[model samples]
Target chain A: MKNNEITDITPKRRLFELNLGDVWKYRDLVMLFVKRDFKNSYKQTVLGPLWIIIKPFLSTFVFTVIFGMIANISTDGMPQFLFFMAGNILWSFFSSCLNGSSSTFIGNARLFGKVYFPRLVMPCANIIYNTIGFLINFVMFFILVLIYMFTGSNVHPNLCALLMPFILLSSALLGTGCGLIVSSVTTKYRDLGVLVSFGVTLWMYITPVVYPVSQVAEPFRPLALLNPVAPLIETFRYGFLGSGTFPWQYLILSFVVTAVVLVFGIIVFNKVEKNFIDTV
Target chain B: MREMNENCVIKIENLSKEYRLGAIGSGTLRHDLQSWYAKKRGKEDPNQRIGAKQYTKGDTFLALDGVNLEVNRGERIGIIGTNGAGKSTLLKVLCRITAPTDGRVRFRGRIASMLEVGTGFHAELTGRENIYLNGAILGMTKEEVTSKIDSIIEFSECEKFIDTPVKRYSSGMFVKLAFAVAAHLDAEIMIMDEVLAVGDMRFQKKCIKKMRDLATEEDRTILYVSHNMNTIRDLCDRCIVLDHGKIVFDGDVEDAIKIYLGSANENFRALEYVGNEHKHHADRNDLCLQFVRYNGKEDSNLSKKSYHCG
Candidate 1:
């Protein structure tokens, strides 16, 4: 035992005493997990990471067929490919955050069961990995933006486009916050793990991924705005596609909700991780 | 200097861990709701069973019940016990991998543990990558692992295959690589559980020597758990025996081993008649019932017959 070192292993109960120091100390571990995610994700695939590029277009094809031509939903004035692809990219960023971070407890149970570090590192790593994915998807989305501009379509990007980084960060935060809570609760109720995947799909429909939030009729708009995810998607569409509304109140409200949920997620995650090995 | 109690660092106070008997959340929602209601009423947990003695099949099992121990710096304590004796559970609680259901532990140190072979190894990752990943998982910084990566690979004797994915490595090679990282992990308190079991004879001797050096030369406190009495005796100056989630003996190393070995046979005899607690070996019917005819002759009557081994 060292003279300066002191550790107390108690039944920890204090909420929101998030240990930032340990998380900062284990930044290398976060990076390792991020690296592992990239390696493991496309390990056996012939295309390796290039599959990520093919993925967006494939999903955009499905969305265009289902939501654009088949269902005849309006994309305001922008081209359908541009609109659907933009939504596809943002949705990918959003869902990846949820899918990656929320399963942190259950997915990494073996590793977590044997070692002790800040439990937050696992989810944080997933967010970082998802952020990298978002950036890649953004680059792909940027190419489509250029093609539309060269063809002389009115694909005007507003000043709000500069808020792309903040929008993506908030989206990642929201997904991670929600995922952490689900992952924490999953130790006790494994049904939540099943529900998370199904729920995120339903969550995407309400977030204006397939259609504009303005497409929803008058009485349901406030209900859709209450989702927090809707406002970010709307702001993102407004910034990039130049064809949607950016309600500042809803944006602040989403930020507040994300902050609160992230705090709660950290609290519950910290609580469950310490003894999850026994239950797990 | 260790004789004086002032160097004491780890002080455990009535540490306990309770495990639910069945299901992920302990059976149906009704049970969980009932537990919640009980806690809400400021009453004892409805499923809380006092388990200082032994565990019976129940709605909950007490894996550890009020364990208390103290150790000074640099003491290599051997934890020995039979299956379900809470040996691994005790180590898990100390490593903070699992929280105790009750009580607290106070220690001064950065604790590093290798509880199982290849604990955090990913099969798809190369040996070099796994080293950095596993070392980081064990709380070592990346630079620390980077600085020692060469030595770790050399120690594992897997130099030619360091860049190959761990899945291609044989089981023995995997364990060696895992153990190499664990051994090099820097910490004030080190824990190892049966790490020497999988190694070859010569490698086992080398690991033992390394463990001895970690304890004596580096002055790191170690808590080693193993069923092999010889290694325990060789490595530990003191030992603690746990039986049924409670420490039955804590004393001189040899005495603890003797008590542990003796009680195991004592328990075998005790289990001959589960319902009746006090049947003597001679009075017990199971002894002579071995060769008794199934023609309804009383086992007691068969006690007069002689039996010979095959």
Candidate 2:
């Protein structure tokens, strides 16, 4: 019963008070949420977690046939199969992170309404869970690249390949940021929730996931790179397949945009979380 | 700012909450656009319900208005109120589930709330796993829950189904397990919202006994909200009655219940009594006397007889 343990409940805190220490105190809860996500997503399924790899495998096959074979899109002279696989793995991670985190307020409205916890735990769990899936896909992609290399294919991973973790994290941060922003808005207006999945689909096409960024018209290349995800995907392909462009300046620009979005998203999320239950 | 007393465990000043009327987003883009257009013309919000009384601010009304109170340590308080009495809203604000529109509450020590039992239970998770999950959600560390895990399971009386998914458990069993977890929470202040409305009679009695022990033995402060005045009288030494976001009575338990039942008001009349006529209802379980009306006549069994009126 120490008097110094007093906690004040007020209507407004500072706008940028992200309450990171509160989140840190609840780290165990975050891990539990991640564990729950992992368990629930695969439970009772025939393939269980194998679906994570199977998903990318099927999507890569479709993109190779549709974009590489039929549309005859160039892969910057890299093998079309591996090229598509690289983009698919990275893009799926980013998109899933975005879509999953975007529904934080809406999906857990019942849970959020009943109890009090740092609201960021939901999206943090989502990103970590999605990151686990991305790691599995990355392993599968790496094995494929190794097999292709032994067979004397020109595709070889370079020193740039070591930047994969950074690329993955940036994509995760960007997606979670955008998702938090959308979730905050969707608490008041559910139309945004309905629009998120479709919007992510459209976002992928512009992100050079199926085609090389080089194929975009020269004048529009800079515009496409401004997408933040565009350069990250290019860097991923550059690292793994060793054929895509790696514009250092654009990469820096992508990181800057990600930082801005993540910071802004957190601020908006903090503001809404105080009383989002009333509206949500 | 007011000076806080050393013994005061909770202090509130001018607490108020305002909730928007009608729809938060009007449920559709067209309606939102219409509201926006109407606002631009300095007209009433198109989304506002027709003939709804507008408060001082448009389409918003206070749930808790200028409530101020302070509680000393180790006080077992019962909060009684009718529907829409802001009892739940005040608990929500204290638990930090939702922020107040204005004012603040300062409290010492951690607050564990049972606003609703099983707040984060997953259907796919086993009963044992959910105990851990729910414990964590209520701010208990893993080791803390681990140490109390055996007692929690034992208290729940669901030992056989501990490893089974909660979805497979009966509704009664679900509530039993949920209450067990909440009962084990080690916090200085416990805020509960009518959690005993479910479960069997034996279990309800067990819960009441356990809570009484916690308040007396552990010296923890307890604030219970309930419509069951019998339990209130049994557990709380002090009581507060709320109506329309204001405290109507705050004193002895018997007096508070009298005020809540309208027996203390001369103009109020009791239309119905809890006679054996309502005994045939299948849901009737606790038939203890709750309220009585004198009607200017002496009845020795009046306290024993319960009356019902609104």
In angstroms, how far off is B255's CA in candidate 2? 1.1
Docking class of 1: medium
With candidate 2 superimposed using the best TM-score fit, by how many Å does residue B160's alpha carbon deviate from the native? 1.2
In the range B39-92, model 2's lDDT, one tens digit per residue, is: 899998977788976444576777898888888788889998655669999999
Over the stretch B139-247, how does candidate 1's per-residue lDDT look in tens digits? 8999999999988999898999999999999988998899999889888788888877666877777787888898899888888998777778778988898765777
Candidate 1: count the clashes: 0
Q: Local error of candidate 2 at A134, Å?
A: 0.6
Query: Which ranges in model 2 have alpha carbons more than 4 Å from their true place?
Result: A1-4, B29-34, B41-59, B263-310
> Which residue pairs come into collision in candidate 2?
none
Judged by DockQ cut-offs, the docking class of candidate 2 is medium
